[model samples]
Target: MIIYLLLAIIIGYLVFVAIRIGLHQRLPLALGPISLELIPDRAAKKYRERPIFTIDIPCHWEIEALKTRYIDPLAWSAKRIQSTAGMLASLLQHQFNLQYGERVAIFKQNHFDIHLFTISIIRAGGIACPVNGKLSINDFDPYLANLSATILITDSAAILKFLQSGIDFGCCRKLIIAEKRALKSEIEVTALEEQMARSYPDIQIYWLEEALLSVQKESPAVPRGKDDPLYLVHSSGTTGFPKAVILKNGPQAHAVRGWLCYVHLSRTWDKGFGALPNNHQAVILSFNSLLLLGFPAHWSSSYDHLDFNAEEVMRALADGKFTGYFGFPVTYTQLKEVPAEKYDLSAMRIWGSTADASHEVIQRKFVSIGNAFKAFGIPLKGSIFLDAQGSSEVGTPSVIRYFTRYTNTFDRRIGRIGSTPFGPKIRIVKENGEKVKRGEVGKLEVKGKTVFAGYWNNPALTYQAIHGNWFFTGDVVRLNKDGHLIQLDRLVDVIHTSDGEVYSLPIEEKLHKHPAVFDVCVYAHQQPDGTYLPSVAAALKVKNSISNSLLLHEFNQMLEGKEKLCRCEIMEWSEFPIGVTGKTLKRVFRNRSEQMMK
Candidate 1:
């Protein structure tokens, strides 16, 4: 009997290996000409070797190239960035004295921040860096010196900030302030322009519109390649000083291609709606991937605006006929609050949730929408809701796990192997650097051409992050026996209690399930005696009428039998602060808790 069992086990292992190899061979053909190629001594490259067509949309101000085809040779040229690139090139050719390696800074004041300006600067062979317009004097001064920006292109607001901060314009040789429409009257406009001229006598201030009119529309082409520096994306300054993440063309192009394949954007029927802020990863995927793959995309001013009137979005779906949508868990929850039949969302083909993992409630809501579409006899295909596990450091696009059909079974093996049609290489490792057994939790690391090169500068930090060309995604995850990856929690968010116990995602997920809670953050509060207390801060929805005391009582009742949490560890409830990305700012909660203890 023992000999027969051993033979069966050996045969099972061989079958698994054969299946994995066969799937890898068949995937490219099944997914429409996508392949992963291993380059000899050049690192593994994953992309279509043949040139692929795409479309470029550079501005929100106009929709000119709505259905244009972007061929490879023309796309790499100066015109694809924006029409502004041609304008800047003309200015450089005529008015500005050309230097071999000069850097240019661009600032514009409009309700919507312009990404085209940064693209234009890169096309002009100039290093482009945009400063935060809202930063105080103390904050802005240090960053200015860090980049050593030589030219300034801004509006009155940025110029005024510079003046208020008493920053010497000696380093900045030229200052071109954009003409503002806010100065309504011609007389007022001229007077304001004259005043700016007088304020910076030595600095040259030229009207951008006037420059455009005088110069030719055609611009001299700037030579570029895969390794050219594209832009600097700054990290949020929540933890400490913000680091400038330097992104290059090679890695960025790889990311754009990977996104195109992952999202299946090459299909003519593909369309997406983006409501996340301009600076976040969702926008990056929507804009860059669309531009790179010729996919149609749309965006709202803000997610909050969309949440207020989700019917507007449904109306858009009916009018524009969108197929895909990307949003966070909070946005999904808001959609659940409204009745489904009020608007026609049957046009939606695929829906994605990012920034945070999808809660059970949100997943149920999505599954219901899918079921409703089918019930109405609309040809609405079953949807895909993915949990994207990656970081900004990993080129803003990385590993993805899709939940196509919602099930109560938490069998983590649903989508584990690269043998699947749409799966990437996944591995879970222990702290001492060994692959953990299946059904065990450990740090998750991913290796692919999709990963970012590294943080812009700060080599010391980058060295610590990327090991043997693999991006160490600071997330705790596990792979089940069925080969599916399950994310546990962020490494930093894990709370270590005084009793030497670790309580992580269970508390946060449980609190979020409460009817009174709209959102919640769980963290550790350290006492003067060095003992840490588990604290939970939450934001209750306006609709919930339960008092704080009742909410607390309900919470204690829920945790009575759970061995992971103690009764004494229950912290006070406070209003949760929100970030620009609409996530509950856990860092702010931790700070507030420390203040209360003091």
Candidate 2:
């Protein structure tokens, strides 16, 4: 009996250590080369056991950790940083007056700015509706009408523009302006405040700074439960008018917990750096992950500044000793054009590119960094690369892949698609809802903890998008025999020419390879004869002027015998319009092509 007791104690100790190692340390380490055995059939059973939550905002120096470890060594107190939560609590207490249980519409310049207010509104038991700042005045008015916002908080210029455009304020009873030095003199701030005081005596106009300092932080009130609607984010509006996607704190909290597991982040260092805009997933990942997980973050204000000079960024990384960095393909492509040794990037441990990157080009760039550059004939040392795959709708990241070897063939295998550690199921289904055979292309659907509830206030569209808990991603993809997902193309962007031949994303990828091409968009345009012709539009950053005819000749040489494209297809060149989200507005190019042909 004594011997049996001792043996049982030893077995229990071993099991505890195994669980700790698997959950916190070893899981993220094996993410790059994970196997089926590593993730068992009962993978999601743990998620069903209990609820875990965390929230952080690095700018405000707020940190909240639950069921995890945060890797910050600075030991900075939460009081030292500006508190976004505090700002919102003040707005609700003294300045703004919304009727009982009224919805507030927040139209800020970017995602991070809006988050400062949105989170507070949700905490105060009010609904938040965030509008995309990139939309034109015409597109924004209808949304405002639909939401019937009682208060409008925005920059001074936006207020003036709305008034000048003849928008009836109707139910909008208050306007609070967050003044910037650049616009302070141009727009008479005092005059506007005085005018609002007189014209609409009941309407209030308050400055952001004064309001924040005057009001004291109140104890958080009992908010609606996790299942109640907290906030709504507008979609990209690629297919048609944008729809608002509603989200609850419960689903978002669970999704974040799953991401923590998927990234294997407990033991990983918490340093987030990225150049992408706040309106996209780049900001969501960098801000949310850092804040919730107790990580430090460094951010740049503009994407263009980061894309032009990677050497400056590398030098900063060396100075700050950042362990992680994230950016788009353009940023990395620009880095490849420079001599990597000139910049001290030894401090970087993990680097990722979220936007589309050609596997061969990216690998070649890495090789040039770690090996010999033919132009300079100087050898360089390469760094490890981390890659992520997800969209804005999910609100959480999935499908992470890492590469250690500087091989060109890396893109041929899983260039982007990998599995989530949270046990979310990925499936490829044909238009008719049948599962495609292995290696066959079809629409991608994700059934996971991270998927959002649905488009906010647009029940008809929501019903169409989410069928029985599966979110139709609308992206064409395929699965290999090894179960790795491969993204093919966007179903909406596929072009069908008058000749009945189908041209797809490969042509666009090939066009982007040219050094002169900064960006490219391919779509179908109606010809003078009323027949749809496959057309390609490109934006050139290079200074050397190349004529349309010369471009056509080069394109024909590249796709001479390719079945997907015809030699006589039309091509146009213009500057690309970048949105606040740091995404190229491909729809703008499509609209331009339609107008030009007409």
Candidate 3:
């Protein structure tokens, strides 16, 4: 009798899901004129009328801009974004001689221009490459050359960096400055332009304002087939130098369709905000998804992208009444300490995380603050925290987990692998490609429509990353007894102690529960005997009263055998090496520890 009841429940749930998905598919695509809002920007001015998404920065930055001049932020509305992008695309094609299929590299902080130029380049039948603006010139030089980019579009800060560093322009013949700025330290724009001319005489320099003057009528979008290359984005590069992943139209379109069916249509999200770095692939996905859904989406930033913090994000969410929020795990870490009473976040329905799985500790605070939806005219009190674990190569999330104020699941449980109909086909396989049994840890592999074509310009490395039809995700994971995916650690970061393999994530989770520990990264350190043991580097709270030794002792008491830390170092938050997409660079510390052992 119990078996029959269970079977009936499962079948009913499946039928309901099928009905929801089918209804979502029938919903019209690209419903017109989505509302877009912007938080106040200091360096922006209204260039056109009927601009719903005007730019404005924080008031503190406005005061600083008086001393040091800044560039004007880009502004446009949903109706105008495409038309303006069309004109820009026309300029690139006719004036700059940017041929179809050529690469146009963008080096700028997160703002309206990144999205504008991306769409413009796609419309022109060209591939858009957005480099991480936070990277130093030394780190940025290799990618510029590797891209063989025909055209380069950048902001004032990057222009200043290039002039100071004397970096080569590589294959790029034309450079377009996206904003007008009186160079910092009272330097004139013309003075910097003259310097650029002398330093890079072979490269033609064009100001964005001047380039837009020759604006042609909005040309019809250049037709593209499903497999045509759309963009080139990089992996997070936490382990090493980032790999350039090639994303095509077909895969991205498929992802959009899948999300629309299983995710967006099921939500009552009124306004949304994204705090993830604009260069990340997930940001582009969010931008596309919101635009198609006809939903209002807001992105907040100051003059300096890296300087934008948790406070600014909170301010935007409060002011915009954002119902849905998407960000990386690092962003959530920064927000964990921010008191709920300080910000009006009650309207938030969902706190969505991708790129990495967020800790339950972080989700618990947020989930307690808002209502997900109304039930029979009464609003529920708790929001949903949706965590999806995937990567750039996969193009879409493979595993998804959701936490509410009520969920009992905790610590490294990443939820189920794959979704209905359109999500990736996921597997846990040994190094030799054999499938792993339940509860056994193995490398995660995924096969799906949304996977990238390959790593750009590195076929040898790409070949190694794929086995038959499955793309190796470089993740060490296991299937739990409940059939959910449990994230152990990245394969490279797993500590191989003499006793056994110790996953860093679960150990870090235990440490994070302590009030004094602000942020923690647990990594493997090699001992004198060439064996590995877990070590910790942590940033503590400002008023933390606990001593390092006492904290370490407390942490160890929570752990059983092999996972206990060998050493604990209290470090400043800045001391942790972070990747472009804001993941901790564990390999750097691992390398340093190995050297110390040697």
Q: Output the number of the lDDT-best candidate.
A: 3
What are the Cα lDDT values of the candidates? Answer: 0.53, 0.54, 0.73
Q: Looking at model 3, report the run of 10 residues with the lowest lDDT sum.
A: 34-43
For model 2, how does the per-residue alpha-carbon lDDT over 1-598 read when each residue is reduced to its tens digit?
9999999988876665445323544333233332111111112122221112122222222223210233442222222122335446446655674443466776655424554566556545667776756566776777776666787767666676665565655577776665433345545766766655655676677666555555555424334665666566666566556666666665555554555564422333435566655545335434443344444555553344223466776676667666556676556655555566676655454566664433445544553332112112224455456566656566554465656555434423443343555534667788888988887777877777657787765788878988878888666766666666665556766554555533445566667677666555566665566545555666565544576667767765665343233323233332445544344555665576668776
Model 1 backbone overlap count:
3
lDDT of 3 by residue, 410-451 (tens): 768886766523668999998787898888889989988889
Q: Which stretches of candidate 2 lie over 4 Å from their true place?
A: 1-84, 97-102, 111-113, 168-171, 180-187, 194-203, 221-224, 262-270, 304-315, 328-339, 355-381, 404-418, 498-503, 527-533, 560-574, 596-598
User: Across residues 1-598, which tens digit of lDDT does each residue of candidate 1 receive?
Assistant: 9999999988886665434223333234334432111010011122223222122222222212312433332122223344445556556656775343455655443222344455446546665565444434565566555555677767766766676566665467677665534334787567655766667667777655555556646454465556665555555453445555565666555655555445643234446666555444345544555443434466554464223356665566556656677776556656656676666666565677666656665655555553223423445445556555455556643456666554554322224545222323456788877899988878877765445556654789778877877666666777776666666666665555556534445566666677777555666665666655566655566644666566667766665333223222223233345433445555665566668668
Q: Report model 3's TM-score to 2 decimal places.
A: 0.87
Per-prediction TM-score, please? 0.73, 0.75, 0.87
Query: Which structure is stronger by lDDT: 1 or 2?
Result: 2
Measured over all alpha carbons after superposition, the RMSD of each candidate to the real structure, in angstroms, is: 8.9, 9.0, 6.7
Pairing residues by index, what is the TM-score of model 1?
Answer: 0.73
